[model samples]
Target: MTRNLFLANRIREVLLNGKWIANTNFKEQIINVNWEKAVQKIGNINSIAMLTFHINYYLDGLLKAFVNGKLEINDRFSFDLQPITSAEDWNNLVKDFISNAEKFANAVLALDNSRLDEIFIDEKYDTYLRNIEGVIEHSYYHLGQVVLIKKMFDLQ
Candidate 1:
């Protein structure tokens, strides 16, 4: 497979489907979480809803950069999830997260192989490949948290 295809597959594996690594993708983890459980804090850790919004924030920003040719995401606002006070709000967040994840994967797959080595947005941000890999790694990190947090709820 081409490098772009490979990277895109990895993105889907983490965000959508494919159980090779963590055995649970974001779709599986977040889709069924009800609004109450999603927002319920299990300690000092972020809620499932917050983590879902956090990952989607990056995906949406990166996908926009792919289309608009500019990267404008700020880390400070990554976790700024608006109030998901109702089931509709939580459902919309999940919907957007899934939609953006797919769009981001498609954007990666559409890239030319040579573009992977090019700087992403700026030299300080590093190459496209590095940023993509970072997304995968960062996602898995948070996915683990979601899983552990879910398990904690299960034990309660």
Candidate 2:
């Protein structure tokens, strides 16, 4: 398979579906979680809702960059999740996340293999392939956290 397809598949594996790595994806973990459980704070670690928003924040920004040819996202603002006090709010976030995950994967698949070597946003940020790989790695890192946190909740 092409590099683009491989990258996109990695994105889908972590975010939407494909359990080859983690045995669970973001959709599988967060889709069934209700508002209360999502927002539940365990110690100081991020809530499930916060992690979801954080990942989707990058997905939305990076997906836009893929289309608009510009990268504009701030890590400081990544966790700035608005209050998810209602089931409707939580559901809306999950819905947007799922939509953006698919769109981001499609954007990666559409990328030319040559573009992977091109700088992403700027030289300091490194190549497109690096950023894409970072997304996949970063996602799996947080997905593990989500899984552990959820298990902790189940125990309590």
Candidate 3:
């Protein structure tokens, strides 16, 4: 009913749906994908795993910052996930994907609506927002791409 209540609900909804996409879209595979077959260079570009890891890598950092409030990480854009060379490893990453997202959702739940406008320095963006809305949106957009890539590889 109040403004704070409304923002809290919005953050909650976005987080829940976003976590769902991460878990639901990820694929389990043994014998890691060859960086070659994993991605298609439609002229010049990286692989699907790279893009997916790009998203997940950001998730790891953003979520940690949002929840823990510690904004320091070395691999800013490194999406290299150490080559998922086994089914178990892939599964673990998927589990981590879900777990970390849920952790973020809980962090959102813990935030006060008043703090939404609290500015935390994002060295990359150089701007801030009231809540984690922008970060969540970023993850969701990439999660969609991850879904598309997974389907493409799985179906192939």
Cα RMSD of all models vs. native, in order, equals 0.7, 0.7, 5.5
Runs in model 3 deviating more than 4 A are 1-52, 122-131, 154-156
- lDDT (10s digit) by residue, model 2, range 34-135: 899999999999999999999999999998887787878999999999998899999999999999999989999999999999999889989999999999
Candidate 1 structure quality by residue, lDDT tens digits, 75-142: 99999999989999999999999999999999999999999999988899999999999999999999
Give one digit per residue, the lDDT tens place, for model 3 in 72-111.
5556546666776555655565556556656655655666
Estimated TM-score per prediction? 0.98, 0.98, 0.62
For candidate 1, the clash count comes to 0
Worst 10 residues of 3 by lDDT: 24-33
Query: What RMSD does model 2 have?
Result: 0.7
lDDT of 2 at 96: 97
Q: Roughly what TM-score does model 2 have, to 2 decimal places?
A: 0.98
Could you tell me the C-alpha RMSD of candidate 1 in Å?
A: 0.7
Candidate 3 residue 142 C-alpha distance from true site, Å: 1.4
- Candidate 1 wrong stretches, greater than 4 Å: none
Candidate 2: worst-modelled 10 consecutive residues by lDDT: 63-72
lDDT of each: 0.94, 0.94, 0.53
* Residue 149 accuracy (lDDT) in model 1: 94
